[model samples]
Target: MIMQKGKVKIAAVGLGNRTCKYLRYVEEHGESAELVAVVDPDPSKADWAREAFSLSSEHCFRSFDELAASGLQLDACIIGTPDLYHHELAVAAMRSGWHVLLEKPMGQTEEQCRDIVEVSAETGRIVTVCYILRYHPYFMKLNELSSDPRMGKILSIKHIERVGKDRTAHTFVRGPWNMKEMNTTVFFTKCCHDVDFVLWLTGGQVESVKSEKGTRIFTSADAPAGAADRCVRCAVEQGCPYSAVDLYLRRKDWIKGFVAQPGESQEDMILRMLDESRYGRCVYCCPENDVIDRQSVVMEMADGVKAEVVMECVTDEKDRYTVIECENAVITGDESSIEVTYKDSSVPQEKYDFQWTRGMEFHAGADHQVVKEFIDSIASGELQTRTPSSEALASHLICFRAEK
Candidate 1:
């Protein structure tokens, strides 16, 4: 498709917070990219698309079918819908002759992921998976050090993703993703990024994985006595760390998902959302939450480099930490910075640090970089996407195996 104004014309299939962050790239780099259309079932998101882009009602569609029927000429489509919808939306967009930039956890199952790969090949439409760590500065540094000649042959890697208490409660325990059927399991939903990071850093696929994982604390057996069904009315909610009253009402955090209704006050809207929606449910009382709360995996890569990955929702803070041990030196990093220490004695620099900057700090600027590169590739008429569905399948299969 020939884009107008020399910019890559793109339509966004989902207008949630994740897609909204990606759309920021289009707004900031207007000369190279354009958001020609948007689709979402939520009225609040439609209102956002209209105001954010000065879009006419015709340009803001309620579904991908509507957007496709609108006949807007587009070079690409961004699929950031829920996990359950990824395979469907991606296949539809690609079959419609538009290349796709699909969000992570490409599909809910191994069969679905393979089908997406097959369809992308059959249609010859580019499919770029959103593994943000591949673009993040911090993880990029880890990849650099893993391959640095001075660091010597790689040995092993230990990576941890701290999903944290508040986020786990909001997204996994009581949110739309609480049940397996609504979205995928927490492993695929969250740890796909972690697993993919290791695969990228190692530059090899896994031979086998020895893993142990489960929902540790968010079960009925762990609930306290006299706990109310919802946190709004629970007497025990006062001292609870995962209190919805504390996170939503008093601090007003994690409310980004629920926007205020057209004429409703913010306070009244939040109150109504808490009482009427799943967000207000007590964390311990959620028996229907089938997604895991903790996971640990030891992956043996094809090159004999072993990587251990740990994902947990019990941490006080949310971040990723990695340690890569090589023959001559040891490298370590949290999301903020990296450090390398040498084994040689009397070296001029026994140890040093590494840090990265950001144009937009969201996802440590990975979101911005992912969108920027995808748009550039499309605008340049590049046949191969940077993160292809074939490459992403290696990492996805590991998470899918967790079900067995």
Candidate 2:
């Protein structure tokens, strides 16, 4: 995984919505990284990448095997495939002597995650799992404050991932990640970042976990009596908050490349997708959609720190609210701000605020920050893979245990 000519030549295995961030990074920061090739089974995605990166036809591969056989020089590979394919793709990339920037929930199962860790160690290839929150300014500040002596030793922590109802419908209800059987659990698919953040902030290994999960709203029995299977044909589509027509058509830019195809107008694509694709499926009536809409897990850490993680898909807003209690003070924050208050009467409560003035700034600008770090690490050979497979596995094991 050696850098050539001061730039890290990279290839993206999956060109989905998440991978767009990496592609954009390489596009903007040509001095640091170069996107040389892309691989996806979908020819439309290949075409999108080719135009996005100005890649040659020879550089567009339909599969990883094709890329490998092409003998293209790559310093690293970004694995943005679906959850289940992560283990195999990551292992193959590492074995091929390319460093890996894998998307989260390292693998579908604990054993698969362990296999990735073992392969990474065996190959001496850098494997950074995309736990983007670690790079976010707010969470980074929280980590720094936790280590301050004035904050005292941490006692317990509570983290809640509020997946807004609109997001739940767009993603978990009718999108690619609608079911546990086809993908993974809601915890792994959505809240693995939360789990990884808990591990990062606590700096302790989880000892045990107890969890309870269920779906309350998005089920067949909960569907309105007059509802149709697809929102485009439904009588209440106008008033429905989770209407596929409104989501895909009205909010075209929200998920641009994912729903809208190349050369197709937003209105036309929205109509076609709604009429033909699973994205148009009614939330409560989609039989194949079965992931839990809400869940909570209680975890005991090795250092006797108690932590509770709650994931709710029905919330009105999408934000991470975290409260960490220490021996002398309590710290609380969301994506944009943080506040700390001490028990001592003489001490005053302190607050820190952040400004999200640009695009993809919701996660405290971690979306691009993580990409910068990965590119810089590869270029300098410093390789600061903050969340390596072994580190990521701890959080994943907790998820696996809790699900049981």
Candidate 3:
């Protein structure tokens, strides 16, 4: 692939929210890259592209083969397809002479990841895995906070993911992410970011993990009598905030933007839509939802950096909960100040209730910062992708062990 005037000619394989984000990023920036080809089975999405952006008609292909065979001068391609197809698509694109910006989990298995890495080395092409949360602004702050020497040797990490009630019932519990077997295991698919973060924070490899998960509130059997496996239709939906009846067809502003904004290059709209949509399907319940609804991992990383990851679908609203107690560490947030309390270790059993707040304010949402950096790296190869095929496998190694 020849570099055209130092700009990479790119093709996007999947037309999902992620694909759209990269496309929009290029559209808005109008400098980092160019969209030379797009591949998606959805004609409507293809049509939207032509109308919203001046994408060439011939540049669109119904399949990857068509795109590769079209002889379009392309340097890189974004593999935004589902988790199962990532490896296959990525390998194909690499063999076709395209560098890859792969969406995360790298692949569903360690073997698959290794295969991709081997192929990349053999092909001499760049491959960046998309762990979007790593680029979010908030996460960068967390990274900075974790580096405080005054924070003392970090002992544990408290991570709580409040997968909204609506999302639990309508999508997660009922959709592609429903089962651990159909696609990638739940850990690799949903919590890969947390795993990566834990690895980054501890600066060590995860030695071992013990986890437990189950379907807490929603179940196919729990559906109204005679209810189908899917919750798109059920009599009890109106009363249950998380029921599929209520969340099934609900569309948030982000979803609207995802559908309406054809030339959109930012992930803000998709993130908002995911944030606004209350359907419980994407996270907790769907046909493909086989992963644990809630689970915790106790990680023993190298150097004895102990950490714990907790993921729960039981929250009224979508929010994050975090706390760090240490002196000399300046903690700040975009919204509110974080309160830190410390007591004298030398003190005998105290009879008094004490509270201390002197450190920096604590803000939330580091995932967004992780995502932004990913885009920047793609635009300007200044920041090499840390979560490449090789580095990515270390996180999923724990999940593979759990399957046994």
Candidate 4:
């Protein structure tokens, strides 16, 4: 289905960090995708979109229902809402004749994920999950090399995600994702991409999953002696790495967007949030912090490929490391480069670099490429050929089974 020659009209549901990426993509590719409508419960988010895209008030909605009832025609919608709300919004958009670019995990439960797959098939809509890693050049190249005859059949694969300690504290400890039952597990929330990569690179279905997880460090027992519940009141806050002052106050640029509310200066906002919000709480003592700081999952694939994925929120640098052992070659890589060694001593080792930029366009530029692919697919009247929702569901199912 080739689309007619024109801009692919798009609406954004939930104006969060991921939505911001979609906004950036549409802005960058103005000729390919048009930002027509925006929805979020927060008016500030809606206003941000309206100002960014020059959208009229009528097109700025507070919820998906409002946008659907408005009767405005659109080619597709990007659902960047929270984990739990993905199914409802995505299904609604698909039923209304709009293609969907859904964020990963699909939903919190396996049932919700299957419903999305069903709805997508019923509606014949293109649902591309945000598996950005699949679009990264490094992984793309790795996939290419995996199929090379020289590599032979893959026997085993291991993937590791080292999420920086500060990030773990910021996002999983003091942030919205702190509670597993309320949000999702560490594997589903942070390492779903890894599970998907294992399946993709091995070309094998997951036969069984066994996992072990625990909050080894970020617990009340690990709190510093005499430390206050809030960093603002802690006597040792100046020296603590996860101090609210250091994390939020020192980083004014980072604080401005999310923390600094209307009429509040950066300093004032930081001080207030530290005194009143969970972001300023001691990481080890945060009552809401329940997710694991580290986890390991071992999986048996249908083709007899043994795979292991380790997720640790204790590193200084955040990146993915993967190693694949094939019959004739050993492949190893991080986010930027890959190294392949052939079994034959005469064959020299080959190294390839992806040259990915560090921040914003992280995941080795997959962040941008995924959006580009989504927009291109919609404009071309074709389904997303790669990293579709069905493929994402397979990964999500593995995470669910592993967590159980």
Candidate 5:
């Protein structure tokens, strides 16, 4: 499928709703790439691709293996399958001499991640793991600030990622990545990008991680007796908060409404969000609901810097927060003083905010930037690639360790 034009022939392996993110990238930057093929087990999605993206009928594949054996001479393949299927699909793509753009977390475990890395090495093919944060301009600014000498040696860091209760029920308790056991670990699945960002920003490895998780709220008991499986049929649909059908309707912020919010809600918003969206179904009432609703972790970077992070599936909605502490700073009794003494009692405090700055022409999100850079690098043979697979693998190892 090689052509004289600027297009790089590529195949997309998944067509879930999330694929919209990648599709937007292609539509906006189609000159650099072409939808050479579309692969998905779902016939509807494949048909949608043909009609929506002008993909030829011959280009839609029923499975990754079918596409791999198609001899289409593809330049690359993007693997957007569910978390559990990432490693195998990526390996198959790389082994077949097609460059791969794997979604975050890389793989489920360190061993599987290593296997992918080994395969990439053996094939001499590029494997770019998508850790969108690396390409985020806001984080890029943070990195610049950290690099400054006046910042004076970052000694500690704190980060928190909170989601409302409505969100928890939709993604964890009901979504495909819901189960915590095998499909995806919360830390690896949800926070791998952040872990990678920490490593990238600090330029250090995670020496150790101590994490704790629990299902603090959103239980099946909340559902009516025998109202199992489908929440739509349950008589409690109108009364119970967090009803799936209701959540969907209220997800206007997701579909058309402006203030830009995820369909999921934090713990505080659970009750209020109940029956606000379609996700409120008593899905958790079934035996398959196993994802963690709350989690916290503390880690020691290889540089001896200690960092604490908490990701709670809360009932309230708040933006992500990151604060860095510099141990080298001294509080001159007048700079916002809170009287301090000497010895170990003089634990000084100074805060630097790393909150993301809003407004950008193409904040297609960090993941899109990562994909763009990877493809650009591959086409131009630029030696520099942001969020390379090996570095992403290290972050995955830290996450895998945390999950364990």
Candidate 6:
């Protein structure tokens, strides 16, 4: 939690990996932002935040309700809670006179999102959703080039989000987002960024939408014969790409959520956890997983721009590729670079580069930019971010409708 002028103190709710990523902004800009408090249900995470930020024990709370009861005077709060708690946490922070930087999808339902907007307006508090991809430089450039006079105007957009198989297995089929009872649809949990990118590029209201979705694989019928309930005990796991043993044991990555306890080795920690953990479940045997592995949506914007979005969870790599067809030219980008081809035969193609260097940073530095903008807005007394709740709500509405 931070702003530059007067060193605005910020609080954090839900001390997860995403929360830590945003707090990196405060860590670098100590002169501008102050980490006054942190709240999380996990005691270990609370301890980590307290030690890292030098926060007083009193400032570490287990819940937002507890923090509110303490009557702390914080200028802002960053909420990284789960889907079910976004509405309650955001509303509470705003009502308590603190601006908010909330992670998306901001709410699980349209009414919840509308309530966030209404409450922010009602309390005169600012709420910015974390739609970081739209802030990516490659996309920002694409937005500019699409409206160039030489290119004419944007007429339609076709975008695809490839949620690579590893991520699909880790986060969707066997993770927190696997079941409908626990979280929202894959569109909200995973692809709201894609939907919002469409709206931001077109700068128009979605008029109508038609969509279709289904699970292509990872169903019980798709399971290989002799598969065990848990990967550790499975006979066919050695060659399975989705094998938890290969990913968590041999690879030793994506362990942020399953860290080893004191005196525990990484292998032992992973095996012990996976023995009964959902992460170790056979992807094809997850009886409770309801998320579709693929979805396609066609949206008609009020500006007469058509946007087509496809999400594929069975891909080998996770990435977003977009094509913008203008009246005179067509533009395409895949994070690495952008290319434009003139509709006229004699015209040459134009290329712009972003260099694909974001792996070391969060979302290729968009996270830092977004956090900095939030702070700058606070410093300038504007109380607005590029992805303010009102604008983010437009994109979220499309996701909610498409889910229907």
Candidate 1 C-alpha lDDT tens digits along 284-358: 877788778888888997888999888878789688888989988888887666778877854443333433443
Q: What lDDT score is found at residue 162 in candidate 6?
A: 89
Q: Is candidate 1 or candidate 4 better by TM-score?
A: 4
Q: How accurate is candidate 4 locally (lDDT)?
A: 0.84
Q: lDDT of each structure? A: 0.85, 0.84, 0.61, 0.84, 0.67, 0.86
Q: Tens digit of lDDT per residue, candidate 5, span 1-404?
A: 22234676788998865555676687778878877899998886787789889988889999988887788988788888888888989998988888888877678777899998899878877888877667766666556655556557767767666666666666766666677666766656777777776676678767789998876354666556656455556676666555665665444322211112346454434433433433444764646666677777788987888777677775566345566665543211111121212224455543433233343334437657777776776667552466667777877777777877
TM-score of each: 0.94, 0.95, 0.77, 0.94, 0.81, 0.96
* lDDT agreement of model 1 with the native: 0.85
Q: Which ten residues in a row have the lowest lDDT in candidate 2?
A: 355-364
lDDT of 3 by residue, 112-210 (tens): 888998998898666777765455445555666667664566666666566655554433564556556657555557677777766776677677787
Candidate 2 pairs with clashing backbones: none
C-alpha positional error of residue 111 in candidate 4 after TM-score superposition, expressed in Å: 1.1
Error of 4 at 119 (Å): 0.7
lDDT by residue (tens digit), candidate 6, 203-281: 8878998888965588888899998888988999998989988888888867779856789997888988789788878
TM-score of model 2 vs. true structure: 0.95
Please identify model 2 stretches exceeding 4 Å from their true place: 1-4, 259-263, 355-362
Per residue, candidate 2 scores C-alpha lDDT tens digits across 1-404 of 64446789999999987788777788999988889999999998988888877899999999999999999989999999888789989999998899999998788888899999999889888899889878877788889888789999899999999998888898887777887876788877788878888888888878889998865678878887788989988998888888888877787634565545658876787788788877878887777777888899889998999988999898887888899999999999876788999989699999988546223443445777778888888787777677788888888888888888
TM-score of 1: 0.94
C-alpha RMSD of each candidate structure in angstroms: 2.3, 2.0, 7.4, 1.9, 7.1, 2.1
How many collisions per candidate? 0, 0, 52, 0, 38, 2
Which residues of candidate 3, in runs, are more than 4 Å off? 1-4, 224-234, 248-289, 323-383
Candidate that scores best on lDDT? 6
True-vs-predicted CA distance for residue 337, candidate 5, Å? 24
Q: Which regions of candidate 5 deviate over 4 angstroms?
A: 1-6, 222-241, 252-280, 328-365
